[model samples]
Target: MTGRNSGATRRTPAENAQLALLLEVAGTPKPGNVDRRRDLEDLRFEHFLAGTVGAGKGLRRAEHGARVGIAFERAVAGMSRQSGGNTQFGCLLLLVPLVSAAARGDLTPDGLDRVVADTTVEDAVSFYRAFEHVDVAVRDPPAEMDDLDVRRGEAAAPTLRERGLTLSDVLALSTGDAAGGGMEEEARGETDGEPGAETEAGTRGIPDWNAVDWTTGFERPFAVAASIRDDTGPIGDRTARAFLEVLADRPDTLVATSHGPAVARDVSERAADVRGDLEAADALADALVEEGINPGTTADTVAAGLFVALERGLSV
Candidate 1:
């Protein structure tokens, strides 16, 4: 709690984005996720710290206006430099755009909307390339989407360009009900300069709810940030609380992929049960780790929320 900041000088957007990553992992009792007080057998607290440090270059890149996909790819590659296989892939996914918006001196939904609206085919290419650098835990894309499967990584670049897909276009394709797009619909700058105008794609692939952030003005992180700011206590407590709140609100995609969707639902129910009590959360944290259940995406959202909260000047 005492170490949330350095000197009194105001930090840059990139600096706050990086610190958000650290503060997220530093928070304790975030059930089923790695935190300062707990660790899984393979991934550890130190690994997250290392991943954050490694991701510094790309965070700066986003601040300097690198394309969203390119900056995200750079961040993932840098984050993989440590022994941890993919410690912060999702966190970086959520941070890049926020950092970019903050750099423009507008850390609001409107600012993020403008940045994502400018995504290009090249940005989509680098985004696919980013998946190659880490073993991200993603479910296989639906059989029909074989050509666009992220697992294809850079190999799908040609296809992406052929379809004129932007990074926003791809993410829009991942949202719930995936209710958007024609064969060549320009998702970039659509819907009054926002991404993901629902079209033909059905909610087919069991949408990566975590990715909804990219399409809907990053609504979840923004909501969680407000939750954190409105609460009282150490930053760690606020983060932990926000994590639980997010988990309770929805089934985590990673959890659904690892376990079953039913298990993911049960986990969310468990989170709902313990969210208001840090002591109960600590107890639940121990049980969840022992059970090998990790709500990874919710943790990522919490990190994203921390970034937004920091950008909004939530006191440490």
Candidate 2:
């Protein structure tokens, strides 16, 4: 039941989730993301490993109505204590609900939506608390809504409390303008603190939190899952291709925040350009890193997708 031989043995959903997170960071040639051979000055492979291990218990507790936000806070806190940095903030955000749903033994798309929809206001507060514990960079809130700024961290908690905004409500606001303004643009001018925008509650909406795969019934993650499900190669190849699929499909929000929308779109186009050739994709990865463009959100989606693949018993 140990080592590679353990693949044939059954693993709990939590174990599968943790392994998926590890596989994600370990996936090489990920293009601008930290991998086994690549490390940021402030983040490293060991840090992500630590974060995944640190978050294990919290992920196991996902069922029984454990608030995802609280689980996320505890997971990030543990990771910070171990690594002194925010190595897996986005991954944790995406994994918690998925892990929770998996724990319920019904991680179907509908089940995931239910788990997300069930999040409460306290969950939203705890999610904000997680931000205070890490130095994760996110886009600004709409210009008019100072209170909704994620950078405000715990300072915005009082208003969140006052407005009784549940985690879903907060996610809805963050999901940005339904007309395709993108999360980065929704808070651009603000509207005197009014709600940002809304979706049909069933249709696809732009994701505000890059790692929040559960927001839209795990749409992006499921898409990645679909791509890799048929692969029988090493887990790394599956992961790498899934990353490309996510990048090619959309501009990464983290890249957009760090660079700009134009740069993000350019990166997406480059990924699309290289999608058919592994060597070209590797070249693109090197170029992206050279230019300091990290498609981190896309990486998070890959991790979530890998989790789904594993949970569904897709051969790694």
Local distance difference test, each candidate: 0.76, 0.69
lDDT (10s digit) by residue, model 2, range 192-297: 1222232223113335444345567878787787778886577887788778878888877666665556666778888898774667888887787777677777
* Predicted structure 1, TM vs. truth: 0.88
Which pairs clash in model 1? 177-203, 179-198, 179-199, 180-198, 180-199
RMSD list, candidates in order: 7.8, 6.5
User: What would you estimate as the lDDT of candidate 1?
Assistant: 0.76
The reply for model 1, stretches above 4 Å from the true place, is 1-7, 177-206
TM-score of every candidate relative to the true structure: 0.88, 0.85
Q: What TM-score should be assigned to candidate 2? A: 0.85
The number of residue pairs in model 2 that clash at the backbone is 4
In angstroms, the error of model 2 at 182 is: 9.4
Off by over 4 Å in 2: 1-8, 63-65, 177-212
